[model samples]
Target: MPSTLEQLTSNRVKLTVEIPFDELKPSLDKAYKDIAAQVNVPGFRKGKVPAPVIDQRFGRGAVLQEAINDALPSAYSSAVNANEIVPLGQPEIEVTKLEDNHKDVLVEFTAEVDVRPDFELPDLAAIEAEVPVIGVPDEDVDERIETLRQRFATNTEVDRPAQDGDVVVIDLEGSRDGEPLEDATAQAITYKLGSGGMLKGLDEAVTGLSAGDSKTFSSELLGGAHAGETADIKVTVTKVSEQELPEVDDEFAQLVSEFDTVDEMRADIRKALESMARLDQAADARDKVLEAVIGKIDIELPQALVDSELEARRNQVSSQLAQAGLTVEQYLKESEEEAEDEDAFWTEIEKRSLDALKAQVVLDKMADEEKIGVEQSDLSELIVRKAQQDGTTPEQEAQHMMEHNHLAEWMEEIRRGKALAQMVAKATVKDAAGEVLQLDRIQPDGSITDAPAADEQAEAVEADASTDDVVEAPETVEAPAAVEEEAPAEESAEKKPAARKPAAKKAATKKPAAKKATTKKPAAKKPVADK
Candidate 1:
């Protein structure tokens, strides 16, 4: 077989192939046998009809057409391989030549599609990025603690008027344009004062109302049969309840947590807050880095990929609408948005989808360049971890996910995360305080570093000090006493006269002093000469 390829576009290719009848013999044989089984012949078993007799009856051109039809796909595929063309979608095949004398078969096809682009990956190591360091404020922890308290709070009946955060049980009736609505009446409905349920004014109508108190307010119903219609709603407060929070003491701590004391509970909460803060910071940092890198690189994405993603996004939106008890048309009608606003919807989805696709391409390229890959063991461990999180057995989860091709997606996510972490580990990261933080202190970077030698040296010194203190206890005491005894003897050998006699007695004093000095000199000289 001989084939020629012509470049149609960046994504499309045209291939013209020619094969001799000898090369197409196998396909012709198979096609003839297939035709024989499907056709009826007198005095012959099914599938036993002779090819030459069938050709005589059906016309030789028709039989040849059937054979060419059967052989075209494989022949085209072979030509594609021979020309090294990677087709995205189906090819448009044309039989350009049909030989009357079983000579050469010429087939021409054009593949209108998108092929994966070939380009060298940008230098990721040279890409500089800053991971934002977000400080977890004290107020954030306090807010989290308050949320926990709210989760544990119980509702209690209150004699006072209803207020925000209080649940009110009420009898309500609504009327639209002086006509009462059957669907807008409730004998007893419990509604939170600020929850924005019922209607916009219903919450405000119930607010400040004590038991047996009633109020009337007008508002528009946003959905249902009375959508966009203004209604006068009368609400009577039957009961008002307020949340009662548990005391924050040791007993409360024991009731809510496994800890025995409030201090221990606070410590645990602090640690949890710190861990969450670190994770949030790491995620924010990763996004900033990706945004920076993406901004620095340029690549053209396949339009086919974008179109496929757009269709997928449309299906997803339709599914969500179906889940919400509405069709896509009904959803658009209810939202007061146009059903034909596909351009607007797809415009937004396409931008996000393209960014996601580009990020994936960048990550995959980086993974390849860095030789970053997820091992089978690592994938298995990840599956086990996810199974534990979802409260299922690893094998069951793995089987379920594999059936849906989610296992591959999960592994890809892991690989991308690992690659991003590797990049972060190599980059310079500083905290809000302008202090460089080690990668281990932030999050797992799929790598480990040994402790510094200075730490080992300090440990060795501490061990030596401890051993010396235990071994030389008696020598320490004797050495101090020996130094004390020598101190006084040395001081006595260096003693001198405190003052000189007056001028009148100088001569007499000088003579005595001279004799004492001579004796001291000899004593000092003896000590010096002994050395």
Candidate 2:
């Protein structure tokens, strides 16, 4: 075998490979056997037909084509290794020469493909980024305490008209143009007034409604049969209940938490919030430092690779918007995004995609240079984190990884993440106050220790892929307050409604269906062999 590489561009290359008859003999023999089993001759049994007879029956070209196809994958892989090229995508292969006379046999082919461009890494120690000072506000701690109070709050039937924060059980009927919409009707549905997760105008319409009171209001259906259509909505309030929160005293503290006094509980809450603030600052530092490093180096990216990434991101965003029944304009408005228009949103997306790709390339190069490797513990930790994020068991996530052949992909993510940590660890990170930040000494509980926490490795694995928040497209949009779902009759009135998070929280939620462990078919290795 003989091969030669030609650099077509900074990020593209062409490889020409020649295979002698002896090198292809194994593939040729297998091809003949396969053809012999598939064809029959007049005097010979099935699979007993000789290669000569099969060649005479089907022409030598057919055998050669099959053998060449069988051999192309190994030949291409070997040529790539021999030339040490990191091809980005599938190659456009052409069989430029083939000779099959009695005395000599040979096959020659060329593959043109995009590849990683060579680039130099800057000094990590010179990189600098400043993150906000970590300060937990009193209001944030109070909010967390209030959340805990709400969890223990008791609901009681109220006699007067319903008010904000009151839970109401009502029968709802929606009709579009005077025609009843089955999907928009439900009975004994429980909703919190002013929660703003149901249909538009629902809060105002039910604000002064007493038990057995009926009110009709016109609003657009958020989901189901009349999604995005305006309908006349009639609500009959069956019950209204007001929540009675217990006083925040020592007894209350003892009941709701491990602390025996309100002061102790408040102290604990403040401590937890401070810890969270520190973690937030650390994450911000990681991203900012990585961004600063990227800004220092210039790398030529292949247009084809950029285009593919952009298309994937576009499709993902489009799918999310479609599922939420929103156009780009509506999503940006409801989400309060800074993008002024759809064009701006997509442009931002393109920029983010390119940045993520560049980050991936840089991290990969650094990993190779530093000889970063994934350990079994790293993989185990990754699986646990993935399981927690996906709301599945570790066993299930492990099965999914194995089923989808994601070990290599995830290992790369881990490797790149470690490389990123190494770079950030060496960089000079500072708070807005100009105090140098020591990331390695930070603990998961937000405490500073003499040594790095045991979980630091796990955190490092996540650092490289944090860009997924920017690059990985949305699976679904945060369901806007403008949307609502029809509840089934079998659902209890006290049951939480099946819908997106309230307008107050815009975090994306995963779909309810458990992820199926789907095994992907391996990609076809046979390249197009034309003679």
List runs of model 2 lying over 4 Å from the truth.
41-49, 102-104, 180-187, 194-201, 218-231, 443-448, 453-467, 470-476, 481-531
lDDT winner: 2
Which residue pairs of candidate 1 clash? Answer: none
TM-score of 2: 0.84
Candidate 1 segments exceeding 4 Å error: 1-5, 15-110, 158-165, 170-175, 178-203, 208-214, 220-231, 234-238, 302-350, 364-531
Candidate 2 at 315: error in angstroms?
A: 2.3
Cα lDDT of candidate 1 equals 0.55
lDDT: worst 10-residue window of model 1: 506-515
TM per prediction: 0.60, 0.84
